[model samples]
Target: APDAPGATLTALPSLDLSRPAWRAGFDETPATVLADGAAAAGAIRRAEIATCIALGAECVGVAGHALELTVDHARTRHQFGRPIGAFQALAHTLADLTVTVEVARSAAAYVTRCGGDERSAHTLAVKASEAAVTVTTEAIQLHGGIGFTWEYPAHVLLRRAHAAAVLAGTPDQHRRALFALVDER
Candidate 1:
């Protein structure tokens, strides 16, 4: 029964990208419903993956778009007496963020191609979740303090990544799914 303590859920509750109400719902559903839930969950999972792929693309895009602007900003934005980007600290940070975003993008693309295998999907999901977190966090860091401010769009990207990580499953959730896939084998 859907009300059972460990039922596997099947139905993908209507979700609003503007909101995150399903995380709690999925957590509570009984595992018994997995028979039905798996199909629905798979569909939902696929959709979520598609969303993440698109988002990951955006992350890559922003990094590409911002590179020039960041270069100019670093060149012009004065610190104590010089441009902040000229400092090794800022340069390294930007470099690291760029690397993270690229790696995340590659991982997402690989995962998108890993179709149908539950185990693979589970692994891919976890990887994508990590990618989402890493890229978004780096994006925020590269942006500096303004990244944290609501007025900046960096927060919006972070929020979307966060939501994507939670959807279908969290990092731990996907890991468990991977284990399940192995066990099933």
Candidate 2:
């Protein structure tokens, strides 16, 4: 990625937040700002699809984390002289989480691989949006009461998914894009 004019010459290989002075100042952004901004907007839409796929992957990871924690809690957290997770409710939850993770992973991967065309962009948006909601909800559910609590990490992931689901474009926006793309054909 070459610097676009006002993009500063840097010794580092990445954007540096440590030195705010070198960052794009208001004055430096006059010429390429609009063009770069437009490019960025378009890129965000595309990359958001990829990001949604990545977030879904994170959901799967969270599922595994939840399972491991569930196992640990089952062994340590006692209820009626037994682990609470030994209950059928807990077992079913673990199973459901596993299934949810698998489904999200498959859906995200499918959309990423298949949705490269203008037509598929809409589908990608749809899947990413859906994945954001589905994955966050399931992740929260699998974590039980703690999942809802502010102290828990699941909420962070859930929030991220929620935000990702809506960014770049909403589901309706993507649907409209699909229609527009098709209409152009």
lDDT of 1 by residue, 126-150 (tens): 6655665665566566667877876
TM-score of 2: 0.53
The alpha-carbon deviation from the true structure for residue 137 of candidate 2, after best TM-score superposition, in angstroms, is: 3.7
Residue ranges of candidate 2 with Cα displaced over 4 Å: 1-29, 33-78, 111-125, 128-132, 138-145, 175-185
- Residue 79 miss distance in model 1 (angstroms): 2.0
**Model 2, 1-185: lDDT tens per residue?**
23554555435332222222233333354363444577888887667556544544544454445455555655677779887668898777667655655565565566667755444545655654565456556656755688787656666656655555564567787688778877888
* Deviation in Å, model 2, residue 129 alpha carbon: 4.7
User: Worst ten-residue run, lDDT, model 2?
Assistant: 13-22
